[model samples]
Target: MKTAALKTVDRRDGKLAMAHFYVAFIALALGGLAGLLQTLVRSGKFELPAGIGYYQILTVHGVVLGLVLTTFFIMGFQLAAVSKTSGTLTNRQRLIGWIGFWLMTAGTLMAAAMILLNKASVLYTFYAPLQAHALFYIGLTLVIVGSWLDGAAIIMAYARWRKANPGKPSPLLTFMSLVNTILWIVATIGVASTVLIQLLPWSLGLVDRVDVLVSRTLFWYFGHPLVYFWLLPAYMAWYVVIPKVIGGKIFSDSLARMSFILFLLFSIPVGFHHQLTEPGIDPAWKFLQVILTFLVIIPSLMTAFSLFATFESYGRSKGATGLFGWVKVLPWEDARFTVPFIGMLSFIPAGAGGIINASHQLNQVVHNTIWITGHFHLTLATAVILTFFGITYWLVPHLTGRTLTKALNKLAIIQAVFWAVGMTFMSGAMHAAGLLGAPRRSSYSEYGGAAQAAEWIPYQVAQAIGGSILFLGIILMLYIFINLAFFAPKGEEEFPVGETSEKAEKTPMVFENWKLWLGITVLLILFAYTIPFIDMIENAPIGSKGYKLW
Candidate 1:
């Protein structure tokens, strides 16, 4: 239980957190609408009105949902977690965080306007040789820099806490928040270098061409770890918050901390796994990175085990009989628990798909196909998105002093069900169609009704139907949040923080050694990336001029 002194809340920090979440939801709404349009257009039954193109819709969908929404939400959620768990943020910290938030929001708007005007149809990846407006790159670069400032605010807060309470292990939630913030700051270095030094200059006409291979190499350097950037927050909820909602304690705090540390060590160097299919990277290096990719899975497996153990222990305490009977005893009625629980379940298949993607031989079969798309939806769309939904049910009310209405509570459950059903139809079909050699990232009518192409139409229709249902689910979520934010009855809810069932014998000092882990992570990244990067730069081909393909 938190002591009275420890439970103090900061109004300024809370306001900052709320501001971040509000912007994130706006992106979510806009992105979901664009996604529905993309699904319809790809289904071949819907056509864009004059002046709008399919690729523009797609670029907006990916950029808003994938980049903007996730970045803002994670920053807000982590700031809140850190402040609540460690202590209230100081006035300076709050001011710094707010500045970051505004810079990020401004950057988002600038890039979004460019996208809307069809000035930058480059997809979220914004791979080189397919340039966007310089403003688009500049705006995104600002978002990254802004996020770094927010991370600095968080780290500074943690540093002060450590100074005041020397030798005390950080609270697990605060520790995990710090881990993710640090991971993000470190991982973005590659992409920041790419944008600031390469893409921005090329886009602004300071340079006529860019080395495609080198640019791509820099992107995936940041890109694959970007997956973990979206995931670790969800894992934070799974490991630290869900157990308390289910009337249980965390299974093991030490294991959880170790997992976070391992993620720091392993996540960044493994990005080359995403480039296994590309040329210019040596096969030996790609194979080595694939092994590192497999290493990253260890932390996730640890997370899965820890979560299940928490669930199983909770079940047995409730008098569940037999070994597996505990599974049936979980708190399925609570949206806070069930939504994240379902997210955990979804990760099983998502993790499997990731392993398949990492396998060099299997990757050749599925690379750039709709299977990858299905896999994407399974991991981020279901696992990350659903957990965020669960966080919303508990978090909004916690921050706003508003009660989640009984009607909205029931609606939350329905929302999860709708999302699952929609993703099932949509991603399942995409996976099947992918195996049959259906293309991805294209409008299907481009195939001109070939025999093989005709086979994918029904699955495309399934995806459209599924996407429509998912959009409805998001709409319902927005309604619940809006009601809670502005109109629900005013009442404070306790922040849920679970303790470990067994007290540790001693504080695990090794787990708290951030510098040690960070240094090792950097070394691993250098080992994995140094040679390939040099090879690409040294053997540069005639660089390609930027294209406006869309």
Candidate 2:
């Protein structure tokens, strides 16, 4: 068995990771406030002070939380994971990571400033026709480029480990981190292409118009994988860390690796599912991508099964008997476990909602409706965000050389409960209201007091109440984060990485074949996208002039 020479992240590397957390939490604070305001406005009970526009705050909410927060936290967590598993980064690697961090940070600031100044209110998707300032696109480009540099650090470390270990699969955490990094690098190419080749020049006035359909195509190409990019790290926690937290072994190393490989292969090529409702794409191509979307579900189910097996095995060994008795043995009192467990439970319905959205017939029902917003809230906001919170309960303290006091742990649990309750009220109402035909991304309006519009009022109020509760949850989370980072009692906290169950067979070496995986991922992308893209460009319209409605 292998053992770590150090129980905590290297002090220098911890500083780097801490830098990211600082920015991420700052974003949470700013973005959380924006979200609350949005809900209140949509409830028909609030208005912005001064000249603040609704879409401007909406842009802030989406960009800061959706893009900035997720990217920073994921990059930070992956860096720490790679360091913990593969050993501290070499000096060169560390330098590269720092450069990436600063670059991304700078980009975030530039983008944020533009949003706040109302120079860019294009929203997170930044879809063309509703164009923003050139700096907005440039800032986004820097963020993507900086992330590539950040990924380079992880890649270099993985290479070093392979060179040293020769013939052994990389450490599970390290390997997962590398896989996610590669997935990110590959997927971002679509967004990067649109930003560099299309959006930036159009925003700069070098082009009189932008191709709306083509821009959206590239965006969704990057957008769908972006979901998995956020998700894979959470899966990393579920697959590797959770078992250790609950005093159990991994169900199968091979299963875990295979699932990740499946994600890499299937996630990017399937972005067309998001574009299914849009015109200009052949129904046949959309159907093909829909098939690919369903294939992505296999890994999701595999992950679910592996987790159940881990929990059951742990419960069984602890003297539990009946089929569901394993549930009783989990560490419910441990905030680290309970918090993310809530997130895992949320995914049940969240996943179901996603399946509904991907269906061609069902897409028409919810597309551009508040129902889609509700689905997004459940998936990313509740499921992914809660898992991240659960991770913070240990991660912050571990990196900071502090211990999570029982009091703080209890508070963390409370925070998670608040989140669950709030989202139930909020997202549930959204889904219901959407079914009644409420539109998304609209400011407060009675729509000439139309009956259907009036029908949405009560649900919008429920959303406001839910948003208020969630903001409280955010405040609690921020308090806990502060205590963990600074005020918590000084001590060591374990960075848990689970051991694979002995009963599982050896992992195949082919899982480590980057050539096979990347080649397949590229081929799938080509197969799914090549023809449609060619058709889009060939039949493209005269494009659109930029508009700044906000």
Candidate 3:
């Protein structure tokens, strides 16, 4: 068996991965600024200057952070993890990665240009009848395609590893990366289909009308899975990397693989949960999808249990006593562990909020409300983004042939604390306002001094304060990133991957049986969506002509 070694990522592969990070961080800087401005605008304390529309900034905020930043960072981190664990990518694979990176970058620029020109202020969701410039659709299509190519590179690398090590399970990190790549590729097909078949044609005037329900349905199909796409990477770090960081063994490789498999199966078919309140979809199908949505919570809870077990095992080994004593034994000062630890802590509330969102009765109350917005912020913004930040504490330095210095490490922990504080204020206020019936995706207004609208203003102002603090957090993160990438001390920083515990059974080979899992995934999706989808098309109304309300 190939034992774990202190191996640096190949310099060539590092360059490819770093290219993705560069774009990711750039998106963060721009998107974070846009986010700050959005909070200020919605707080009714500031207005866009020089005719820049509120929706324009909103579009930038959502697209850059929600789509661009997440996609780029995830891709970059996965590539590096695969390379470190599986072996360096071949020259051709690296070439494919570069091509995908540039394509995504070009697409991002094209789409951004249109948005900045005020011709594509449709927001990140870009749901029609809110049409954007044709270039915007085309640009986004390129991004999706580019992501496919990037995924292809990861798949190829995995294939090569499996071929070389015929009887062995793939490295846990590599396997996890492969799973996420597959999930992304499968999930993106929904968004890609909607864009190519529906939105692009309508935006280009090739089609006079677009099906709003179908477009939205397709979007939510991709949309719900997209959150998992952001999340599974964090889970990878949580399951495989965190144990190694904190001087503990993986609780069970089998359990980890099982949870990831469950996520892949349950994550994709539950889009109707998002559309529960929308018309034209049958409640039965919605209920079924909601059940699938709830099933995904199983894997999440499993992960939590595994982590607790690992922590307790480590603490007990260290002679710590008492039921919760393990928590005290954890390496609290290690940024690599502590930063993502905060993210893990945040997910408790985040997951609860998700359960509330997915519930049918509760959905009616919070539907289209800022509560949904708060839930989203907590899930991706705190849980996922903070974990990504944690990864960067070591990843950027490791890739750059440097070490995370003590000062920088301390800064990273501080940055995470700032993020936690800021998100609490922001997301907390959003939930409060949303429960009070504040609408989402709208600029500030008093509704002619209506008392209900008046009630939301205080929360909005709290959001502004939180956003400002979050912006400072962003600035700190960027500073840490720049130092890690360009100026950190020249040395080796380990790319940690944990070993499985001896007490755990070997990971089942069945976990690697893609055909079986994928087959079930497809069947579940068809069972949930195929009938409703066909009902949509067969009973379709005359589609609405495109509108640019912004």
The lDDT ranking, best first, is 2, 3, 1
Kindly list the per-residue Cα lDDT of model 1 for residues 39-150, writing each as its tens digit: 8987889999987988899899999999999999999899988888888888899889999999999999999999999989998798877888889988998899899989
TM-score of each: 0.97, 0.98, 0.98
Clashing pairs in 1: none
Q: What is the lDDT, from 0 to 100, of the residue 239 in candidate 3? A: 95
Model 2 — TM-score against the truth?
A: 0.98
lDDT of 2 by residue, 157-179 (tens): 89998988889999998889999
How do the residues 409-452 of candidate 3 rate in per-residue lDDT, one tens digit apiece?
A: 89999999899999999999999999999999886753655777
TM-score of 3: 0.98
**What overall lDDT goes with each candidate model?**
0.87, 0.91, 0.91
TM-score of decoy 1: 0.97
What global local distance difference test value does model 1 have? 0.87
